[model samples]
Target: MSRPMEKTEILHPSLQEVHQSVDTTRPGSLWKKIFAFFGPAYLVSVGYMDPGNWATDLAGGSQYGYTLLWVLLMSNLMAVLLQTLSARLGIVRGRDLAQANREMYPSALNFILYLLAEVAIAACDLAEVLGMAIGLQLLFQIPLLTGVLITALDTLLILFLQRWKIRRLELFIISLISIIGISLFIELWMARPHPIEIASGFIPHLPDEAALYIAVGIIGATVMPHNLYLHSALVQTRKIHRDEAGIRRALKLNFLDSFIALNLAFLVNAALLVLAAAVFFHSGHTEVAEIQDAYHLLEPLLGNHLAPILFGIALIASGQSSTITGTMAGQIVMEGYLQLRINPMLRRFITRMLAIIPAVILISIAGEHAVGQLLILSQVILSMQLSFAIIPLIYFVSDRQTMGKFALSTPIKMLAWLVAIVLIYLNVRMVVEQISGYIIQSDSIIGKISAIAGGAGFMILLLITWLYPIRRKSLVQKGYHLHKPQTPTPVMPIHPYHKIALALDFSEKDHAILAHAFAQGNPNTEYLLIHVVESVSARILGKQSFDQESQQDQQQLAAYVRMFEEKNLKAKGVLAYHRRGKEIARIVNEEQADLLIMGGHGHRGMKDLIYGETVNYVRHHVHIPVLIV
Candidate 1:
């Protein structure tokens, strides 16, 4: 007889595809929806107060004073424009900006944009590390390097927090925002200036050459690149139902959300600039690099107690709040572009090390001045990176295929293109300035040619990046399955009251399986960890006599118990039971374990009889959840 028609089993769709299929709805409570909308922007706000921003704000205030306040407004306006587009793209398209860029561009163009993005993120990370170091310097008098090393421990701590619910993370962020707001507000109030002069500062006016750099600094601090990426990703976290009504409400609420949060960000940034302008601008201090200068200057005017505490709080909040956002941004980039799945701790470590290593090496060799230069350089790099992302954002939003009925109006598209062109031109000019001054003598003809060429090449590259997605059909297909509908899964909640017992045979495979399960499982539920101490392998099985074996078994059990306790696992006990005598199912039955998870492979002999020595035996006997890894 012909072999029963052999057919390949249909493969299950990936978990990600399934997740995307789920429908989202606007929250019933307007307040809750408003709160959720503000969630992602906080990450963006960190860029405004990071150590790099501190450096620029101090430099600008001390040099140009209130005259440069207009730049802060311009840049914040720029940020609102770009970030709003990013948010709209996310809600309407069901994709973050980075992922959108990747799908739309060619392989070569996508890779370049990806490389720049990685560098931009790394720059943000460096600023975060330095900010943390500054915080340590203020709080504990620790050296920057030591403080940098201590940051590694924070990754593990952050990972631990991931076990908690998402709402808890939101609460933590809100608390940080409150701290940052209070600290900055007090500092601004301390630096009281003439109301007329402050008002004129907000009005547009060009200052001297010395003030130009400060104006640039204020602009740099406001229009940060990572904030754009962050806002896009954050808007996607909402559960907005796909219908027109839900989508429209999400748009309205999100715009309101951006308007409120970004306005506050503007106020905080303005406070930093004002404090600097009022205190240092009038004092003939044109170049202040360290955050300490802000405090020292204030000491004679605002008294010792308020000044020191204010700067210290600002520094601490700047570092801590930015670190959380930087870490999350790394997660989004890796997952978005590479489609790589990584735990939060591992991703944080990788991103932190990359950002810190270069910073430490450069700081050690070049000192604080070099670190300050790196901060400015990071912003320049951000401007260059922004052009690549912005062009695509404008194009995609205008495209009927992606935006559907929500495609941009002609005026909006025109405005977006105008913004893109201006950003490209400004970025190009900055690159030319850097090349002429740093790469060659500013007066040399060769330097001028190189600078012009550099600017031209950069603009060309950006144009290519924008055109790439429109040209590559194959990549578009492979990179994103845009029309795939998300499937809904029944929410199955494991009761916290239900006790679970897990049995492992001391194999690496079993340990790996348990780790995966734990990462995917709810932490609220209680679980018992058990390591069976049977004489299974030759290396460990026959090495000891009966008394020695029992002692070894006891020791092993104790160690495992301690390990679980340290990891915050709800391990009940580690019992030394021989598989030779006790049935695995029978033991689970006695212990009243609602679920049984064990190694898939088992050895023959009394092991099979007592332990249901193999998975088959246990399956036959246990009427419980048996997960064989």
Candidate 2:
């Protein structure tokens, strides 16, 4: 079995920090069970109602009145269905959309998809940066540019939140969601919109060419591509049982979570549009398109200062909440597509910078009024990228081999494709309309050439993505690379381990654990000893802890390393912080250990309730064989 240890290098999971990080196995009531699975969707839900959304809904309501309310409704329905499919993909396949796309699509196609996803994220961050800056301007009267600078500091906040439990972060987002919902409710109540008109707004109708532009923005803002990618990875944070029955149960509960969470987002969005319709459109302030304009007019129209104050508070909350999830989605996409790993702080900082630089440039040149148009343009870019992500998702979930019995039924497959086609059609039509209008108005040869070239390039890329999967099947059938079929490689016999890791607790049994670890290793073999400091100081301060217990643990580990060196065998000692079993797994992977040997306390039954079973966790998290002595 040791012979195969070198072959057992498991690929690191998507969102490695939080993959199966939540414990839903706690014996509890039905309600308690429901709460356990409630987090991921709440996290994804915030993205659906982020600052980008506020811009579109505000523009729609102020300009088109409640006519675009149906757009929001339609977009919400689309969002709910697509998000449910994303969750189902994650729970059933254990692969996020990016991961699935990489595995299923060709390499060149994967790179393009990755780029498109990044563009979507950057566009989203643009809206978020502007939204938050606008919020600060409205609330505390900060200069817009200064507030934009201030938004960059949230990278630090993301790094801070990441150090805590996943559920804690989810709760933080939920609190923000509540603030936004309450603020919207108050705005709706104070405006006292005619109930009949609000109802009529739900009936679908686009009033003009301008209305069509805002309608696309609303749809783009609502059913985001990044959110779809984000949702799949977030659902994997839950510890779902892997059997058919267990997976089905997880799917059912997560669907409930998505339904409730997304509907709340819908209400926030609907209220934004409604508030604008009632307060601005009817009041003859129809050009109140920008958030700042709406903020200023809120007090005069609603007859209260509190209306704008609540608006600002909600806007800040939305921007802050959306950015956190946006960074996480960035991580998922980068790791899933390119297999690149970087520090979480660095990743967040880089992503924020991408968004910040664009906003800074645009604001410096055109001043503040142009921010609203930029926000809407960002959503349209996101809308254009939707099919690349969606088509792959449909291909994966519909495949019988990938999803097994849980694969979507034929009718559902058609519906999913229809959604994808509609998104693609809207995106193409909008881009063509913009280009055609631009070419007609501009005499600049370079500008027209650039516009047409860009449009054609994107269309070509989309066509390739749509056809690549089918083309792959056809290539193999045509025996394009036909040589005779190769025979399968035969398995070799097991050999003794060449490299071993010992998980030591510094208890007296550590020596016994060492004896077991050395048994399978030859004189040429190397050894690594791993221990985690779970003391209060070590837990709180991590590697910087200089407390007595940490010092002693460090010294003890050094002593163990010296003892092994005396035997003339290669060896080293490593200190890990926080959780014991988790650290042990990380160390084992880092050291490239062929096997892990750890001593069990044999604390079964009630004793297990006190100290926990770490050995099981280590084995499950690591690919190497674990020998519990």
Candidate 3:
């Protein structure tokens, strides 16, 4: 077959607007280039220390008094390993976890995995919403109901932030992470725990089943499923050369990136558990599972008002930073699995609403105190979905046919399997314990049926994914993977363009665009010159628009057609009045053009926000080849 379109380009790309958008190939000092790979992991790091993590950390520390610090260390190590593998997949295969799954797994299985992924994102988003709302309440004395409602506005923040560069978004997340780290440091400084006890806590001792549960929680909260999907896609933001040497360099640098960012996340989490151990567990008040209670207890117990204020600030930062990343992860999985794209603002709104509606109902019916349990429940829900993401990721990166020279070696693959087994066991154990508790103690038959049915379905899914066979030999022959055995690209039949679409504006640059279109075909080609009238009247009135600007646009188009006729070329002029990008896409489809030629406005940064990036919009919506001059 003629070389099929690159898998990423087959349908669409992951985070297409920012895909390979950041430049890492520029000549620079090694450290400068290393720093370019740093931001994606930092964004992934926030998920490790999100609000979901706080509940577990605080609970682990306050109840066990730093005894589970080893668990925190263990979980962070797992996070680093899995995240590195994720980045490896993206860097080498140019496919996120979701997209890779789409190609490798059957469609029915893929759909189920997609639903599981969405549920995971929604659960994570719930924690963020609750965390931010609670932080606002603790710091500003805003009522919890009002604070929860206020959290909805962060979707608007997402809309505003999506307009800027990916690096800008990363910088914003890093700033928030710094705030959280500093706040934790200040809290730790004020509550001085015994150094020996803190050191002894890393001995891997678990006092009881309660300690085990908390340990598993720390792991679940740390090794998030959504972050795996996010990291795989986010690493693609940096443009890296695809040669072996460059691939090795990128793998090395991304490991460093994961090490630094995840360890920072570990520090933030360790501080949370340790802070609770010192201020609450050691002080004999061990019931500080609730964040608000922890905030209240901090000021009195630590004898400083700034402690609570800083705590609240850190909480807000954590929620805000994580909510942003969560939204991006939602986008990745949706686009990667479903193979469709939606407005960022709309996705944000939908994800946020899924969280908010439940939070509001719980608070209204049971009171704000119930939110603490809800946070824990969300993490438990996430735990159920974690294995599905992790198991497939390990399998993908482990396949020699799938990953080629970058495939995980036997030793590393075994180790990755080890980590997978550990996490899967811990998550399953915790899920069983939680579900069993409800089954035995609760009276609701609906809850019982839901628990049993969901567990059975999850187990069935686990078996299906794990046992799903891969036809490695067939895959290699088909050249479906980046690393399969090489064959010469088949020189297939060539088809010249009979009709070409040229997207233009009545600017001096139009000449350059027209030149490129002519280069594609001679006078035999039927040229369709298309321009979108974007005036106020045109935007509101469509074809009926009779404003002066629209009339002038018509005249300009007619003149272009006349010029083409004078040049002994067949040409037709099409004028559309509406959303420029969609209108152009519609006319291109209607005209059955095989090739599309347009000019890049070279709009970057804030200029893109005002003038809009119609090029990206149109490219995604159209099926034709786009040649941007």
Candidate 4:
């Protein structure tokens, strides 16, 4: 005879295969993957031309002209390299940037890095919301505070998009980018910039102190922190294995898509600079703050009022296109770092609300110039926060154990090291510059000393961040355990709806005993009423022709029998049961029944006799807490 299969053996696949097969091919051609890679990168370009970017670009143009356009080339290249690394790490390792960071490093390091990254992204988001509100103010002439509040409504808009195909949604966003792209391209065409000057801008030479600062600001504006987070998480959308081939594919395509999108961004940014340089560079335009300035500057060359309208369309497109990527990135960061899941709408609202607060408050009191300063400073915040993400990506990609053969090569490691060093230097420079500026602005010697002391203290905080994780982990691993106070367990009150099950047969005395037991005992525990119908003897009865009709109707009669059993219980009960065609122990084993209650009849007959074999079978079969009544 053949052996029966065990239950566990029937349910699961081999462990080795589960991770190997992730559903990569759905309902589409190869073009779908190409389009998807295009989606998130382009969505991120919103940050590139945000009202904040507008201010920085405006300042660079008004104060320095096309001198800083060279920065976009380098920054976009950096963005492509880093974003691709992030995406490849996520796709190859099956981990988000934060989770990967947490696993690759000591626990304390993970938590600290996670916290700092969250704060930095949140700060960047605040600036984006502020810029959106400012854009609304420029376009619609709405109150800044009201515009900020209205920006929260974008959450609802994003949530509705979730029901559509992600591809279609991406295409819609791409279309918007194209609209903005073409409009900007047209603006660039109409501007008729001096070809030699634009070429010189690309040749990379800073003319003065003002030019150097604007160049730094452009680099900061072009490469954003959230794009790195967004790209890494987005790469996971494509199905990729941990093998070198999959990593190579993901790395190649992601970098290609990022390069293309960012290059487009670079062209648009350069056009903005060239347009500004041509129209306002030496035209005695000392301070130009409005969309009207770019338009007014262009009217002389375009000989049409259409330029302002096209500029408005482009600005709106820039704001509208980026909203989804920001929302999606917010979702990834929240879920990745905290393991918190929320609908997209609520997450976007939280980010936008935080961002809008400072933008509105400052813009209302201080004007667009202050808003411009906020944008520049926000880039500084972005660059600083980027290290939170970059450190983790570098650490994990460089790890041979996790990545195996796909681990970073020496050349890649060197590149990452360079990126890390540059980030640290930039952060330090920003801090030093801010401190020196504050000292120069102050009147008293005490204030200068305080500014210097604060800057030193801030640097210490940054150092502590990197060291705290290692120290905390070391102390804990050394067995110097820190204990937290335990809270007392709560007393749970008995519930009236509580119940208990008492198995039964057609015995009046058994029903009476159960009624009395319930009346005396607490009602907190729930009863699971059950009936077992034996069907192994069904064919035996029919073949014997003693109870042929009754045997045929056994399944139908089981429900009525249960109802009769419930009727006899007197008190209320919940119904539950198992059936068997052979040994009663089979059902007991399957249900692991808490108790077995069968009648010991007040009758004398061979059929009514108690069976020790049945009781012994149940006792041997189950190991749970059991009762026999």
Candidate 5:
């Protein structure tokens, strides 16, 4: 007898394989369990310590001399709390933040949220690309534009690593993070910052307007909008039991993972600030606002030749590590909100290109100063989008209908709201201050008009985002339904078919296709099950035939046929050894299928553009009506 499929078995197709690769059933020590849940938080932690954070932290430390350290600490605390909520949303509800938003909100609202999220991602990527280029310039004496082009090639590296193992990718990121930590620790030792002053820096203080501007930048850089979405999706990587105890265990382990990783990130950020304060500020280089400026000063100020080299190395590591995670976050966001999946390679290229073009253009026109200003502007843009993500996250996690028993406790809920309110206020104030400053400084009448119009337009958008109804009135009014379990229903085809052809990939999505196909099946219909085994590798290796591969595919197809036969349905299986896309098209033609039904991963953006989807190829190749389940 076949085991019944659990709801938890359904996952985003791209992540399904890596989801829960750890052994949940094995009786293991606490350390083993901790190890299993360790990867996601570290991936997210990279964003916190990325090159974007560096610009803000360096600026804060050099200009304010550790007075803004409290902002970093506060931001890290906010990250810890929000990330815990994000992980719980994924583990308990089986939905990433984007998916949850899609399910909960109307299309119009979701579209607005999607656009804001994209802007945040682009801003992040801009900082990363700019930082990497600067690092390359500092280290190899390469031209900035040339280095920007070189950074785009990292997309190929990202694609290669993704095809490897998820664990390998995680370890690679962790290793880079370790390099960053060690590099900064050595710098901290060399700088010899006062322990008492460092401790006092932890106490919150805003000395003036300039301090406030840097503090907001620090907050924006620290609690990233994309990381919230990325963490929610990444936690779903670990496959855990969907039962009560399983969720509780996963949540505990996930929170611990977030806590440890975020603290490490906090330390790295603090170290950057402390090093800047001790070495740069004390030496009267308080105006060192740019990474390039910092690099040029590090060697002379510290009197060690290695100081500048280490800084360059750490900057490159930060940019590259952050780039990889930013790409993944882009994939997750597109798939979850838009139900669109694309080739990971193309997705990386598209996002990287978007960031590269403007950066290169600005750098070429304005030169080096533009890079620092752009990096800071990117963080500010991220801060503006931060509330859009946070508000939805808090809303979904607090709803009893959404989180069930895992709904936030009363005090926690209050705390989350307080955080949300504070972030919203900070973002608004930052925008107001920027426009007001522009108005005061502008000598032209046109400049004042532009500032007034931009400020007004931005405020209107924020008002709409806040007032837009995300939940249905009845759902909101009904409040928490602690006892009821909400199960999403699958939409099935309404029209009956005389003949149907189904494509199988033997992936986790195979069962979902089967369920949808069976839902549309009847006694009168003839069902054809087709599985194709590609011999590209065999051909590459100079082998004529893949007998073992063909045999395995045949067996799997037969099992599927048997499963259908036991249900008393007229079904037959076909195993073909050929290329995936071409062979599937041929079968659809030869079998004379009236309606072709198959599973689709629904890739979007550059992935869809660069590497065309098989479903798309098949649709164009054949004349039969097709339905992608």
Candidate 6:
């Protein structure tokens, strides 16, 4: 028996570029050190105060007064603790929660987790898109469906912003947070909430079953599952030394960042509840549960003209900020869990479309009231998926093998487990209560039976996950391996002429192709690097001369040739201007090459058809052996 090889390389996504934009050497002032760790938590905090949360807070405040405020406070404290652990996982282990899960779990279990994560992200995005739509409708008198369509354009905005410095994106989100905070401050001031009552609201009391349901909603809305995944990955955006002292400093600064940003979120949530309690509850409108209800009622009850406008502004800001982070989380989860990568723009479009489709159908069929219910239901779905993320996080961070010297201490481990148990219990209770309501309200016998069966299966799944072993050594022993018998090696046949023509596109994949080609090349083999510069709009109009393009290509080709020459390989550079596939075939034949080597994108089906298969075209045209990487 033999052990599998260990994976040593760190994975770097586009967000990793943030590491280059900031100095993390700890050579600055105390404030500067704190500033470097500030961005990720703000991104995480937006999930806490997004429009999904606004519905729960507004509903809780208006219906139950300040009674559910204690839930809001407790959930925020839990968020701070969990987010700190998430950041520690990234800083210490150099992997996000999704990547960590992929590394730890079996293929079947990893796929299950990936599906759950996608569902959770789609649910979160649904709330955000709907919130943005409602905000547009409230502010600009647009239809709900029209606003939903309009919200899709933010994908372009994200694409545009990401082209600039990452720090600028952070500042933009921070500015939106400031707008939300200011808006809430103005609304709270106008409402004149009772200070003593607001203070008493933190005393931990649930009035009835209805309060408990809303309390669960508050927890779901606060400790978002995607935020946990996002934070772990976001912490990796800082360039930190891979040493104990560096990890310690980064962890401490990240804790402060999470604490401050989450507390700000806490204030915003509390202010929303407090404003509702003062204006709606006091005015005998105890059932103002939806956000639109709160927005419409604010102007008449508070006698302030800017109240509704500010509320709508805050909603839009929250939705837009949350949409950005949600899209990033979708990318992180897909790449991390499944090891599948797609263009960020396409990924965003797909996730946004998944959310938008459901929202549009429901809004069209059931109207705006259904949208409000769907928002709350989305948070509930997030709550159900929270345990899948949290349990793995606690198990990994507490394992000495995974965390090394940065592992959680005994006391913190106990506290984290306690938090896990409490959350699990709350989730189960919510699920049971929801199922019981469905079973009782349904008229069809089949529907009742189905609800009961589904609830039982869900609970069983949770039980299995809870009891799953977390010890690393045992898991490694049970892991599957592909074993093959040893066989004798065969000798290779050499060709009389050895000349290789390498087509260069200067893409990242080109490096791999070059490495493969060089590994197979011999000292006697001659290599010619060819690059073609196709004229822009040549297909639409006529071919135009591109002198500067030819010069740049020649420079790039010469640089590559020098690289090969330095490695003691015989090489030459050729620059040409024509259609890429046709010119590459021409170069291979004119150079009298024995083989053609080129890099390819490896796309399939419609993508190959849409992008056009240059490698396929060149292969059909060339007479020699064509190796496509």
Q: What is the C-alpha RMSD of each candidate to the true structure, in Å?
A: 11.8, 9.5, 6.1, 16.6, 9.4, 7.8
TM-score of each: 0.74, 0.75, 0.78, 0.67, 0.76, 0.78
Candidate 3 on 1-629: residue-level lDDT in tens? 11212335433567889988888999999889988888999999999999999998898889989899999998899889999999988888788888888777877888989998999999999999999999999988999999999999887688778888999998999999999999999899999888899999899878997777778888888889999999999998888776778888989999999999999999999999999999999889898888988999998999999999999999999999999999999999988777767888789999999999999999999998799889988999899999999888988787776577788889999999999999999888888888789899989999999999978887788888877745343222221232334578989975888999999988988989998888888768999999999889888888899999999999999999999999999999999987878888999998899999998887764566688888999999999899988
lDDT of 1: 0.66
Q: Write the per-residue lDDT of candidate 4 for residues 1-629, one digit (tens) a residue.
A: 21111112212111111222333445568987555445556666666665556656766776667777777677767767777677666565555565444434555655666665665666666665665665576567877678677877776667567655555666787787788779877877777777887777767777788666666666666666776667666555555443556456666776777777777877777767776776677575747644445655666656767776677677666766666776766766665555556655566777776677777778788875575566666777676666566655676666665566667789989997787677666666766887799788889999999878877865775666455444432211221111223578999974443333345443454566456445534534334444433344433442333244434344433553465456563233322222221234454455444444433434322322233234434556655433444
Model 6 lDDT per residue over 514-574, tens place = 8867776788888988887765633333235546665576688889989988988899887
Q: Which candidate is the best by lDDT?
A: 3
- Each candidate's number of clashing pairs is 9, 0, 0, 5, 9, 0
| Sliding window of 10 residues with minimal summed lDDT for model 4 | 7-16
Clashing pairs in 1: 21-486, 21-487, 24-240, 24-241, 25-239, 25-241, 104-469, 607-613, 608-613
lDDT of candidates 1 onward, in order: 0.66, 0.84, 0.88, 0.60, 0.83, 0.83
For candidate 2, which ten residues in a row score worst on lDDT? 1-10
TM-score-based ranking, best first? Answer: 3, 6, 5, 2, 1, 4
Error of 3 at 188 (Å): 0.9
| Clash count (model 6, backbone only) | 0
How accurate locally is residue 428 in candidate 2, as Cα lDDT from 0 to 100?
75
| Residue range 595-624, candidate 1, lDDT tens digits | 777766645433433444457666777778
Best by TM-score: 3
User: Which pairs clash in the backbone of model 6?
Assistant: none
lDDT of 2 at 528: 88
Candidate 5 residues 1-629, lDDT tens each?
21222334344432554666655546789788679878899999999999999988899999989788889889899999999999987787666778777766767777878888988999999989988999999999999889988999898678667765677888999999999999999999999999998888889879998898888878877899999898887887787777778878989999999999999999999999999999888999999888889999998889999999999999999999999999889987887777777777888888998899998888889986788778877887888788888887887777776567778899999999898898889887877777798899989999999989977977786666666545354113221111234698999766778778899988888888888777777888888998877666443532245567766777899999898888888898877665667878998899888888888866744465365578878898999778888
For model 2, the stretches where C-alpha displacement exceeds 4 angstroms are 1-10, 474-629
Cα deviation of 94, candidate 6, in Å: 1.0
| Per-residue lDDT value at 312 in model 3 | 96
